[model samples]
Target chain A: MIRFEGITKRYDQQTVISDISFEIEKGELVVIIGSSGCGKTTLLKIVNRLIRPTSGRVYINGADTAAQDEIELRRNIGYVIQQTGLFPHMTVRENIEIIPRLKRVNRADVEARSVELMRMVGLDPAQFLDRYPSQLSGGQQQRVGVARAFACDPEVILMDEPFSALDPLTRVQLQDELADLQARVRKTIVFVTHDMDEAVKIADRICLIHEGGVVQYDTVEAVMKYPANEFVADFIGRNRIWSSPAFIRARDIMIQTPVCASADTTVMRCIERMRTRKVDSLLITGENMRMLGIISAREMQTCEDRGVPVSRVMRRQFEKVSPDENIVEVLQIVNRGGLSAVPVLDEAGTVVGLITRSSLLTTLSRPYLDETEAATS
Target chain B: MNLFTFLVQSAGEIATRLFQHLQLTLLSIFIATALGVPLGVLISYRRRMKKPVMGVANVVQAIPSIALLGFLIPILGIGEKPAVFMVVVYSLLPIIKNTVTGLSGINAETLEAAKGIGMTRIQVLTKVKLPLALPVIMAGVRISAVTSVGLVTLAAFIGANGLGYLIYSGIRTLNDYQILAGAVPACLLALLMDFLFSLVEKMVTPACFKQN
Candidate 1:
C-alpha cells in the first residue's frame, strides 16, 4: 500500500497542497480529478519524491519515502506524464530496456524483457525495435512511455494526464488499453486528470481535489451520487442534478428535427430556416447526409459579403457529442470546448439533432433550484 | 618512374613510414583518452571544479603543437617523448569536453527511472548513465583521434619517424611527390580511424541508446 500522511507542500508562503492524506492499496487504480492548479499533479509528485512535502510523510509499503534513498525509492514506482516523456534519442527497444539495464540484468535477460515489454504495450518488437520516438505518433509514443515505466516490473505507477495529448478517439482507446494493462500488471496506480468521464471510466476510487486538498475520495458511483460540497458539485459540473444526468443521453436532450442547410442552398434560404425555427445555428449537411459545417444566425446577416455557399460562412470546427454520451459529458463537451451548443451525431457521424446551452443549463439547474424551493417551503 | 620499379624501391620506406605514423597517433590518443575521460567525468560531477578543469584543458589546447613540441624538447629532448607529449596535450580538450557533455546530457527521466527500479548509485552510473553517455563520448574520441592524427604530423619537427618525416623532407627538398605521400596518408588515416571508431562505438552501444 502507498500512503500519504498529512502531506503539506508550500511554495513560499502559499500552500500548494496542504495536509493531504490518502492510502492506495495494491492493484487499485485511484484517480484524482480537479481543475488546473488544484494540486492533483503536486500530490502525485510528492509520492515519488519528485516534490517533497514540507511537513508530512509519504510511505511506500510502510517505509517512509523521505527516509529512503531517493534513487531506490523512485525505481520502485513507474511514472508517466501527459507528454509521454520518452527519451527522444533512444529507439523504442532501448527506451524499454533502460530500467532493466540499470538493474544490471544479464544481457540476454534485458533483451528478453525488452521484447516482452514491447509486446505487452502492443508495439511489435520486430517492427519497432529500431524505430525512434519521433517516428511514432502521439498515441504510440504514450505506449512506449508506459512500456518504459513498466520496464522493471515496478509495483506502483503514477500517471499525470498521460492520455491528454491524444485526440478524443485515441484518448478513449488508450484509456481502455490502460485499463487492460492495469488489470494484468495490477500495479497500484494514481492517475490524475481534469476529465471526469475519464476519471469515472477507469478509477476504482475517485478523489476530487479542490483548493489544494481532496474534497472527496470514494468509489466512482459514490462520488457521483454524493458530492462532498458545492465546489465538487461545480467542478463535476452538470452531474449534481437530482435525477442524475448520467441516465440522460444526448439523444434525450437534443432537438430531433434540427434545422439544417445544404451545400448548394442559398444563404438567404438558410437564414429563413433559422428565423422560422428560432434556432441560432443550422447544421450544413452533404448529399450523403454527412455533417459539413455549422452556420450561425449571426453569419446570415453578413452572408452576402461572406458568400459562395452555406459552407463558405459556416464554422467547420464545431463541437459534437455522440448520441450515447450522457448529459454530463455533453455539458462537459460544451463547457470545456467553450461552445454555446453541440450537434448530436449518431454512430454514422451524421448529425441527428442539436443541443443548446440554455437547454443544458436548464437541465443542470432544475435540481438545485428545486432543493432551494423545498427549503423555502 | 616505371610502376614496378617505383613499388620495389618505396616498399621498405612506405612500410616503415606507415608503421611509425600508426604508432605515434594511436599512442597519443590512447594516453589522452585514458587521462582525460576520467578527469572529465570527475569535473562534470563537481560543479565548482568544472571551470578550473576546463580552463586547464583550454590553456593546453591554446598552445600550438609546434611551439609545445619546441618547448618540450628543452626538457624532454628530441624523439617520441616530446612528440607523444605534444599530441596528448592537443587531444585533451575534445576528449574531456565530450566526456563531460556526454555524462551530463544523460536524460533526467532515465536517471529517475533507474533510481525508481532499486538500482544502487554505482549500478545506475555503470549501467544506465555510462552506456547512454557512450555516444557523446565516442563523438569526443572521434574529434580527438582526428586532431591527434594532424598534430602527430607536426611531431616530425622533433625527429620522430612518422608520415611527418616525409612532409618535412618534401618541404626541405621541395619535392611535391614526397609532400603528396605524407599529406594523402595522413588524411586517409584520419578518415579510416574515424570510420573504425564509429563502428566500434556503435557496436559497444546498445541499440536502445539510439532512441531519442
Candidate 2:
C-alpha cells in the first residue's frame, strides 16, 4: 500500500501540487487523471523519488520514502513512461534485463525471466530479443518497456501514460492486455493519464485532479455517477460513462422500485398492477422478496384463467442478472434472450431492481439529451 | 637534378624523416584525446566551467601553429617535446568541442528514462550518455587526427626531426625536389589519418545507428 500524506510541491513561487493526500491499497490499480499541467506526472514522480515533494511524506507499506535511499527505492518500483524509454543501443533482451543485471541476479535466471516477460507482454522472444528498440514499432517498444518494468517482480509499478503514444487501435489492445495482466499479477499499480476513457477502462479507482488539487478520489462508478463539482462533471464529460459500458452496472441504471407481486397474487391482479405501474412485466417473488419468476403482460393477455396464481403462469427460466453485473453483459443477455425486462437480484435471491428495455434506452440516450438540454437552456 | 631523381637519391633520408613525422603526429593526438575527452565530459556536467574552458580552447586554436610552437619553446626547449606540445594544444578544440556536443545532444527523454529506471549518476553517464555520444566524439577525434598530421610538420621548426626538416632545409637551399619529397608525403599522411579514423568510427558506431 502507498499513502501520500498531505503532499505539496512548489517550484520557486508557483505551486504544482497543493496538499494532496490519498492512499492506494495493495493490488489496486489506481489511475491519477487530470488535464495537462495539472501536476499528475509530478505526483507519480514523487513516489519514485524522482521529484521530491516540498512538504509531506509518502509512505510505501508503512515506510517513509523520504528516508530510504532513492536509488534503492527506485529499484524496488517499476516505472514505464509514455515515450517508452528503452535504450536504443541495447537489444530488447538487454533492455529488459537491465534492472536484474543491476541487482546482480544470476545471469541464467535473468535471461530466462526476460524470455518469460517477453512472452507475457505478447511479444515473441525468439524474434524480438536480439532486435534493437529502433527496429520495433511504437506499440512493440512499449510492450518491451512494460516487460522491462516487470523484470524484477517489483511490488509497485508506476505507469505514466504508458499507452498514450500508441495509435488508437494499439492503445485499446494494450489497455485490454494490461487490464488482463493486472488481474493475473495483482501488482499495486499507479497509472497516470489525462484521458478519462482510458482511466475508466482500467482503473480500480480513479483519482481526479484539477488545478493541482484532487477533486474526487473514488471508484469509477461513483466518480461517473456523482462527480464532485462542475469542473469534475465537465472534465469527466456527460457521455464519458457510455464509452466504458462495463462500469455501468445493473444496479446503477435499473429501476429501483420494480413493480413486484407476491407469488400467490392472482394473474388478474398482476396484470392490474402492471397496468397501474405502467410496466409491461411483474417480478413475482416468494417470501422476503426472493425473486421466483417474471410474468410479462403478453403472458397475462393470453392467460386462460384470470384467478390463477402468478407462480403457475410466470416464466421461471428467464434471464436474470446480479446487481454488480456490468451493463454490457446485461445488454448481451437482453439481446440474446430477447428479454423485455431482466430482474436484478442481490444475494439471497431477492429482486433488488428491474432493467427494462425502455430504461436501457433512456440510460443510453441520457448523455445526448443532457447535451441538447444544455445547448438550449 | 630534377625532383624525381633528387627524390629517388634521397629515399633513405626521406623514409627516416617520414617515420619521425608519424611519431610526432600520433603522440600529440594521443595526448590531446586523453586530456580533451575528460575535460569535455567535465564541462558537460559543470555548466560553469564550459564557457571558460571552451574559451581557452578557442584562443589556443586561433593562435598560429608557429606561434604556439614558439610559445612552448620557452617553457620546454626545442625538439620533440615542444613540437608534440604544440600539436596537442592545437588539437584540443575539436576533441573537447565534440565531446561536449555529443554528451549534451542525447535525447532528453532517453536520459529521463535512464534515471527513472534507477541508474546511478555514473551509470547513466557511462551506459547511456557516452555510448550515444561516441560517434560525435569520434568525429571530433577524426578532425584532430587529420589536423595533427599537418600540425606535426611545424615540430620541425622547433628542431624536432621530421619531414618538416626536409622541407625547411630544402627551403633554405631552394631545392624543389627536397621540398616535394617532404610536402608530398605529409599530404598523403594526413589523408591516411583521416581514412584510419573513419574506419574506427564505423566500427564503434552502435548497431541501432546503422542503416542496414
Candidate 3:
C-alpha cells in the first residue's frame, strides 16, 4: 500500500517530475512504464527517498515517508536496481544478509533467511552462499539481487529495471521467475520498466507515464483494449496485446450478437430460425438470455419428431468460456473438442456473446494481416 | 683484508644495523597507514577536501628524501625521531593516494546498493568501500614499505642508527667492504618488505580476485 501525492522534482531550471500522483494497492504488482527520460525511474526512486522530491509527499501504509528516518525507512523496504547492485567484496550470503544484519536481526535467523531466499530465487545456498558476485554470471547476479531484496522480508519492494540489463532469454526467464515470486510472496511491489510487453506480462496494473505525468493507470486488459490517447496507443503499439495472448480475452474477439431461440421452441421452428439466420446451431435460452443448451444442425436432422421441444433434443453438457477468459483457453477448448462455437457467458450464466470458429480465426489473424498491409502501403 | 674476511668480521654488526633498518621502515609504514587510510576515506566522501589533500601529499612526494630529512632535522632534532618522521612523510603520498584511488574506484552501483539496502554511511564504508578497496590500499602500503626501506638508509645522515651509518661512514673512510655490507642488506630488506606485503595482500584479498 503506497501513495504518491503531487510529487514534483526540479533540478536547476528543468523539471524532472511534475505533479505526478498515484496509488499502488497492497499485494499488487504495479508497473510504472514510460519511454526513456519520462521520469519512470525517478518516480521509483522517490518511493525510497533515494531522490528527494522538491515538493510532494509519499505515504507507505498510510505513514508519511518523509517523517520516517531514511535509513529506517529503507530497511523496511526492498530495493533492486538494473545493475544488480551486488557487492563484489561480499559473498552472496553476506550481500543478502546485509539489511537483516543491519536491522540487528539475530544471526541464526538472518542466516537461515539468506539460505531460504537464495533457494527461492533459484540459487542453491550451499553452492552460491560463499561465492562472490564476480563469480556469478549476469543472470545469477540479478537472481542474487532479488534474493537480497527479499532477505529482510520487507512488505514493499521497489524494482527499477531489474531485468532490463540481462540477455533476452535470461530477461524472459527472470521476468517469469519474478512474476512467480510475486505470486507466492504477495508483497506490494512497484516495478519500473520501459518495455510494454514486460509490463503486460507481469503487472497487475499498468501505470503509463508521459512527460512526468500520469497518462493512464488501469488493469492490463483495460489498458490494452482501450488506450487513453494516441500517445498511449502508439507507445503500447497497436499489436502488442496480440503478442501477449493472455490479454486477448473472449469478450475482446467474440461476436456480440448470436442467433438464439426460446427453449420451448419446437425443432421444426428452430430449423427455420437457423436456416433464416444462416447458422448451423442455435443457443437455446430461457427468459433473459440465460443459457439453456445447444442443438446443432446434425442433431436436428435426425430428430424423429419435428414438433418436439428443442430442449429435449439439445445437448446440455457443452463447452463454454467466460467473457474474461483469455484466447489461449478458448483456443484449447476449440482444438480439444473440435467445437464449432463456444458461448461467452457472464457471471449470472447469461449468454452475452458467441466465439465462432470463424470469428476466432479472424481475430487471431488480423494482427498479422494488418502488419503486412502497413508494410506494403 | 679481502671482502670475504671483512663480511665475516662485521656479521654481528651488520645484523644489528639490519634490524634497525627494518624497524624504521615498519614503523614508518604503520604510521602512514594509520594516517593515510582515514584521510583517504575522508577525501573520497568529502570531495571538497580531495584536491587540497592530494595536493599536499603530491608536494611531499616531490621533496627528495634527503631534503625531507633535512627539513625535519631542525624541527625534530638529529636522531631516530627525524628519520621516522621523514619516512612517514614520504610514505604518506602512496598510502593516501592509493587509498583515495582504491576507495573512489569502487563500483558506483555497489555503493548505491549499499545505501539502497539501508546501510548507514559508516557501514557502507566498512562493509563495502573499505573491503573492495583493500587490495589497492595494501598495494600502496607495499610501495611505501619497500620504498621506506631504502629511504630509512638516509636516517643515518640525521645521526640515527641504521645500515646507513655503515654506508656513510665507510664512504668517508674509503672502506669498500663496509659500504657493501650496508648497501647489500638495505637492498635485501626492500625485497623482503615486498615479499612480506605481497603475502599480506594475498591473504586479505577476496577469493574471487585471486587467480586459481
Candidate 4:
C-alpha cells in the first residue's frame, strides 16, 4: 500500500500541488486523472521520489519513501510512461533484462523471465526478443514498455497515460489486454490519464485533481453517480455519457438468448431455429463460441438455389459491439445500417446478446432514462 | 633531382620524423581524452558550470598553436614536453565540446526511462548515455586528431623531433626537397589517422544504430 499525506510542490511562486492526500491499497488499481497542468504527473513522480515534495511525505508499505534512497526505492517499483521510453539501442530482450541484470540475477534466469514477460504482454518471445525499439510499431513498443516494467515483478506498478500515445484502435486493444493481464497478475497499479472514459473503464477508484488539489477521489461508479462538486461534475461530464448508470449497454439492452447457430450447422436447421424464434437473421459462431458473421433471410435465399452451406451465404462484414460498449454508439450502427439487430460480443469474442432496433429503441425511449439521458448527453 | 628521387633518398629521415610526429599527436590526444571526457560528463550534469568552462576552452582554441607553444617555452622550456603539453591543451576543446554535445544530445525520454528504471547516475552515463553518444564523441576525437597531425609539424620550432624538422631545415637552406619530404609524410599521416579513427567510430557504434 502507498500513502500520500499533505503533499505539496511549489516551483518558485507557482504551486503545482497543494496539500493533496490519498491512499492506495494492496492489489487495488487507482487511477489519477486531471487535465494538463493539474499536477497529476507531479503526484505520480513523488511516489518514486522523481520529484521531491516541498512539504509532506509519501509512505510505501509504512516506510516514508523520502527517507529511503531513491535508487533502491525506484528499483522496487515499476514505472511505464507515455513515450514508452525504450532505449533505441537495446534489443527487446536486453531492455527487459536491464533491471534483473542490475540485481545480479543469473543470465539464464533473466532470459527465462524476459520470455515469460513477453508472453504475458502478448508479444511472441521468438519473434520480438531480438528486435530493437525502432523496428517495432508504436503499439508494439508500448507493449515492450509494459513488459519491461513487469520484468522485475515489483509489487506496485505506475503507468502514466501509457496508452495515450497509441492510435485509438490500438489504444482500446491495449487497454483491454492490460485489463486482462491485471486480472491475472494482480499487482497494485497506479495509472494516470487525462482521458475520463479510460478512467471509468479501468480504475478501481479514481483521484480527480484540479488546480493542484484533489476535487474528488472515489470509486468509478461513485465519481460518476455522485460528483462531489460542480467542477467535478463538469470535468467528468464532457463527452462521457457512458459512465452514468442510466446509460444502458449492448448486453443489458440486447435480446438475451440470441438465436445463434454454429456455422457448420445445416442451413435447414438454422431456418428452423429462426422460424421457431420468429427471427429473420441468425448469428453464426464457430469454435469457442466465437461470432464469425451473420446470415439474414435475404442472403439465405441463395442457399436453396445454390445448395450451399449457411456459412457460404452469410454476410462477413458487419459492425459488432462488445458487452460493455454504450448503447449510443450501438444505436448509430443499428439505425445507419438498418440492421435488424447487432451482435453483442463478450471479451472473448463470443456472442453474448443481440441488440435489435426495437429492443434498443424501447430501452433508449424508456421514461425513466429521460433524466440521465438529458443530463449526461 | 625529381621529387620521387628526393623522396627515396630521404625516406629514412622522413620515416624517423614521421615516427616523432605520430608520437606527439597520439600522446596529446590520449591525455586530452582522459581529461576531457570526464570533464564533459561533469559539466553536463552541472549545467551552470558549462558556459564558463566552454568559454575558457574557446579562448584556448583561439590562441594560435605556434603562439601558444611559444608562450609555453618560457614556463615549461622547449622540446617534446612543452610541445606535447601545448598540443594537449589545443586538443581538449574538441573532445570536451563533443562530449558535452554527445551527452546532452541524448533524448530526455531515454534518460528519464533510465532513471525511472533505477539505474545509478554512473550506470546511466556508462551504459546508456555513453553508448548512444559514442559516434558524436568519436567525431570530435577525429576532428582533434586530424588537426593535431598538422600542428605537430609546428612542434619542430620548439626543437621537438618530427616531420617539422625537415620543413624548418628546408626553409633555412632554401631546399624544396627537404620541405617536400617533411610535407608529404605529414599529409599522409593526417590521412592515416583520420582513416583509422573512422574505423574506430564504426566499431564503437552500437548495432541498432548501424544503417542496413
Best-fitting candidate, scored by DockQ: 2
Write one digit per residue (lDDT tens) for candidate 4, span B62-125.
Answer: 9988899889999999999998888888888999999999998899988988998899999998
The alpha-carbon lDDT assigned to residue A193 of candidate 2 equals: 97
Model 1 TM-score is 0.67
Query: lDDT tens string, model 4, A6-59?
Result: 999999999999999889989888999999999999999999888899999999
Q: Which prediction has more favorable lDDT, 1 or 3?
A: 3
Worst 10 residues of 1 chain A by lDDT: A238-247
Q: Which candidate order results from sorting by lDDT in descending order?
A: 2, 3, 4, 1
Report residue A319 deviation for candidate 2 (angstroms).
5.5
lDDT of 1 by residue, A1-377 (tens): 98989999999999999888988888999998899998998898888887878989988889988888787677778888754366555677766776666667899988988888888888888998789777888988898888878877888998889898899998999898888988877889999999987887788998888888889989876776567887777677643434445756787778787778887787878888888888888899997678888878887786565436777777888879898899878878887988866898877879888898887877667777877887899
Q: Once superposed on the true structure, which residue ranges of model 1 sit more than 4 Å away at CA?
A: A10-15, A35-39, A69-72, A82-136, A144-155, A180-186, A221-230, A239-377, B1-8, B102-107, B118-133, B169-181, B194-212
Model 2, residue B36: distance off in Å is 0.4
Q: Estimate each model's TM-score.
A: 0.67, 0.92, 0.92, 0.79
Roughly what TM-score does model 2 have, to 2 decimal places? 0.92
True contacts kept of 3: 0.75
lDDT of 1 by residue, B138-199 (tens): 88888889878888888888999898998899899987777767878888998999898898
Fnat for candidate 4 (0 to 1): 0.65
By DockQ, rank the candidates, best first.
2, 3, 4, 1
Score candidate 3 by lDDT.
0.91
- Higher-ranked by DockQ: 3 or 4: 3
lDDT of each: 0.81, 0.92, 0.91, 0.88
Q: Using TM-score as the measure, what is the rank order of every candidate, best first?
A: 2, 3, 4, 1
Over B77-173, each residue of candidate 2 has an lDDT whose tens digit, in order, gives 9899888888899899999999999999998888888898899999999889999899999999999999888887777878998899988988989
